[model samples]
Target: MEQKQFFTEKPRILIVDDELGPRESLRMILKPYYEVYTAKDGISALEAIKKNPIDLVTLDLRMPGMPGEEVLKHIKNFDPTIEVIIITGYGTLQSAVEAIKYKVFDYILKPFNVSDILSVVKKCIGRRYVSGEIKNVLEKTKRDTKSHSEIYEQITHFLNQLNESCYYFFRRENYLEFVRVLATTLESKDPYTVGHSERVCHYSSLIAEGLGLSPDEKEKLQISAYLHDIGKIGISDIYISKDGPLDENEWAIVREHPIKGIKIISPLGLSSEVIEGIKYHHERFDGKGYPEGLSGKNIPLFARIIAIADAYDALTIGRPYKSPLSKNEALLEIKKCAGSQFDEELVEVFIEEIKKNDREINQMH
Candidate 1:
């Protein structure tokens, strides 16, 4: 008795070809150790992929409407993990070279035997799975490295801004430069929030320093503050800066910014403390906020501090649909909302801090 050879488990192979003969023939040869899926052309192959998971693809080089090369490009574009083995009845060196560039697992000529086909299929699938993992790791590493580079850019920008004479004009000029870059990139989606971030930074820094935060703490607070509204870029501008109050549908988009900002900044490997400051700045001392609403001391200390600062800046700054409040008026509004909307302790600190700088308040143009 002969022993039967099999794969570790049945691998799914999608056979894409115009003709039925090759598809069925290939299925018959590999069906013992593989679950076969057949697609008549590129469209069908794509549809099958969305409907079911396909591990490997045996693609014919020529087909009606969409050719193998075009199909291969789409497959790689959609999901590069799936290995594609290009098969051509009319094989040539040019075809092989083209296939190589497309990163096809293997290329086989016509009149191939069952053993020959299986040998290539096994090799292709093995290479595909391993290479897929390697590709994924490389991509993730690239992203991490890219994010580190961004942080490096942000830090460099900060250092340069700190040294610049203009930096003395505002604490967040450098940080706002970075945030503004993100804003411009996402301007098509949300211009209002870009300005909103700038406002938050301007206000948060004044409040942070007013509360006598250490220079280091002030820097972190300002960065977090400027970026607090950074998450709004993920939301559509139409929904974010709506001329009228946002409807429930648009409001959902407004609420997703914190999570989105976290995801955006997570790759930078920033300290969790800074992330939390941005995450919970919207919470109220009286327990009414979106995303997460923790009142009183339950919220992080820096977050509570920012809530007052953020609101102060927001009220003082003019919006697309509203007029800016006067400095003293804004102060009174802050005082009005102190115990309810903001942390009372931080509010008193902020008020005292700003009151001393009457000249600065008058010049906050």
Candidate 2:
């Protein structure tokens, strides 16, 4: 089946500058025509892009930490169709020129004329692609007084005529991998639960298949399971390291993880299933769960699947306060709570899947 096609409503433009004044000013100027984002420095600028699709960036030539040119290089390497325009001071014209080689769409002088900025942006809106001819023009650009050469102007006009707007997926593959690494890092906080999230992912996939979930549902389930516990990354080491049972206060903090998970994963532009799975996985079948008491079918299907796998992993892997349950013991406990803690039908499917000890369950077997 064809993957679902994703679309963005408006062009997203990021204004990257260390100076708050200029960054805010650019955001204000572009706010009407586009969805504008600001970054105080280069690192945050790249992070912002990772969080969402950035159709264009009006970049300040100078910034501390990561250089503007380096950020441009990363952006081009990530997705060349993302148009970049240099916003440079008179003294930094040389740096601006350097960025052109990396496929900067255009440049404007600092203390920019609103008309000039708007003119270039208006022309660039549907003009995200860069042709070889345009790059050759940038390469051959001789310091000219007419803002840009005649050839560059001709190429720009030609591009505008082509109307090449870029479309991007809400989440990039590399960023999703980065999020996996983050989950791994959180698990690292306790040596016992190391690889816990990954195990849950594997088990969840098997459960999803046993339930005859569609490929799309399975795919989303995999992503949600991997990222489900990301909120634990925010928990203090003190709490995560406590060797004894958690007090009521500590338990409250622990229970807040679902809410925290939702917040951290909100900007990722995930599907509603994936987001809801992360938010409501802890909810129970008997209307007795924290965060929300969503019961039975009220809880999202994906969340229920994740909850089964999550509980299985947690029980078999043990925790700070308890020893790991043996395979048979964990299965018994899961069976005991089939209707209260987990979806009844899902529980039966999961138990059969676990008993089958197929390749997916090799770890437990």
Candidate 3:
């Protein structure tokens, strides 16, 4: 999709600056013609982009962390078409020239008039809006001229392309934001779950490597590990945050999260392998899990791999209800449950890898 495709409503621009004064002033001026949001720094700018939609970015050249050039590269990597305007100081002609080479839309000097910025934004909006409208018209024409059945097929193709573009365009931020929300929400209810997802992803990928799984299988396992508990998002805080053991009824609700998460992302057209991993990560090797009671080998390989990582992280991480087990203790606990709760061989391999890279692993997490 073109840069213009992102601007459908009012032009959305994210102004990033460390100085509160300039950031707010830019917002005040751009608010009239476009929807404007301000970021105190690049980190916040990236965070905001993940949570919201942005068409154009007006970026300050200097910031404590993540200077303008770096931010521009990130925005481009996230979505190549995202238009960015660099904010340069009057004497920073060299930086302005460098930004131009980096595909910045334009550079605006500091102490500039609001009307000057306004005019530049107005031109950007017109370019984006008109181009998007033209693309829409062309697609409509294609649909009208095609046979009815073909037209429907074409529509599906276009929609899928659009979804994929949007998916990648926002995937980096949205995915991270989703994790943050899940982690924070879980943390609010129970502090022990803090950083649970990230830890699981790291361990699961390592285990996948230890098992020498195929590249595709490793990636699937990694994604499933990261999102395994996404369904937990829908579970009520009353059930999730409880310091005491869940009652039978609460346990039943907790068991349904795999299916819930599967349902949530199914429409995204992810690989069936990834879906299966998410759905069965909680199932046991001995057929004693919730949602499904699939036995050893019947449980998907990716799911079995994740079970080890997920359980290990849970045991190692401090939870509201229980104290964190030491690494040795956690390993012993995992070994005890190997036949029933985890794939025994995978667990062994995971432990071996951990022992071999113990120091490196500590540094990583």
Candidate 4:
């Protein structure tokens, strides 16, 4: 598997213009702050992008051979993440309007103000690092797909590329939202457990906040809680939403979900604690859990927190074999298991939080 290496450094800006004076001035304008690259025409501009990671590109609409519109299409087809700011000449309003379809970041009319240019650049270069790795994957996928003229092959290749990028890109940068999406995807597979993971995350966060967890710890817990059930997505589709009780074999498959979830999230650069939570949220406090049952304080702290939340949500929500418990009923169930399935101290925190704001909790029948 080819790994995507995304940006982790100063932003790289590319300037594309046919005219000498404007291109030079644009380069000089952004030179002090950005690592700048310049190309006199669209052909050269495209090539320059291929050679290096680029955060933003400023392109002139009036290039000779490869017109700005065509170049912009190729750029979009190549790497859509590259922020493109169009430089339009007089009477080119029509061309600029058409370019918007390609999703150019914004258009900068000719005789541009320096401050306006600076502001646009600042806004477009949203990330500190360029998406170099995804760009490489996108470029390679396009090249491979283009080589085959069959529409079927092209569509298949495009879909595969989309999945690859979604998995890799969502794992980094904006990971919290990514975890939410992953949980939703899992819910779609298991009709019996809709919204289970998110409720777990919400409950766990409440407990974490009560414990005075630092912002970073809360983030880890949030991600862990959301993805704790992700491993179940790996189960055979037949077993996900089956109506009755599972046989021993089917139950075994269900139990392997934590490990499966860990594999799916392994590449997203999660902290060890978050990984631990996903892997051990089902563990028992009495040292009686599967998949390496380290008991008592030996279990990861975040995992312990997720376990309480996981159990609470399960008790409160009606599953295929169980009736939903009321808030107090669910609380009693959790309290009954505190010294066995959950961390006693964390349970105390969760109980306190619920008492303080019991009205906010769902009273699902």
- C-alpha TM-scores of all predictions: 0.48, 0.52, 0.56, 0.55
Query: Which pairs, if any, clash in model 4?
Result: 231-261
Write the number of the candidate with greater TM-score, choosing between 1 and 2.
2
Structure candidate 3, residue pairs in collision: none
How do the candidates rank by lDDT, highest first? 4, 2, 3, 1
Ranking by TM-score: 3, 4, 2, 1
Q: Which ranges in model 1 have alpha carbons more than 4 Å from their true place? A: 1-195, 360-365
- Model 2, 232-294: lDDT tens digits are 655555666578888999988788777777766655557899889999999999989867899
For model 4, give the 10-residue run with minimal summed lDDT: 147-156
- Candidate 3's TM-score reads 0.56
lDDT of each: 0.68, 0.74, 0.72, 0.75
Predicted candidate 1 versus true structure: per-residue lDDT over 1-365, tens digit per residue: 01012234567899998988888888888888778899999999989988887889888878898878889999888888788888777645468557977768778777668878976776665444433433444355446664533533443343343233222222242443343334333332344444565566666776777767798787777667666765654454566667877788777767887777776665444567679887888788888875687888888877887777777766777567877899889989988987788888888877877776676767864
Of candidate 2, the 10-residue stretch with the lowest lDDT total is: 162-171
**Alpha-carbon runs more than 4 Å astray in model 4:** 1-173, 359-365
- Please list the residue runs of candidate 2 whose C-alpha ends up more than 4 Å from where it truly belongs after superposition: 1-178, 359-365
Off by over 4 Å in 3: 7-165, 168-190, 361-365
Task: Summarize candidate 4's per-residue lDDT along 219-275 as a digit string, tens digits.
Answer: 889999988987664565466566678899987888887887787666565789999
Which of the predicted structures, 2 or 4, would earn the higher TM-score when compared with the native? 4
lDDT of 4 at 63: 80
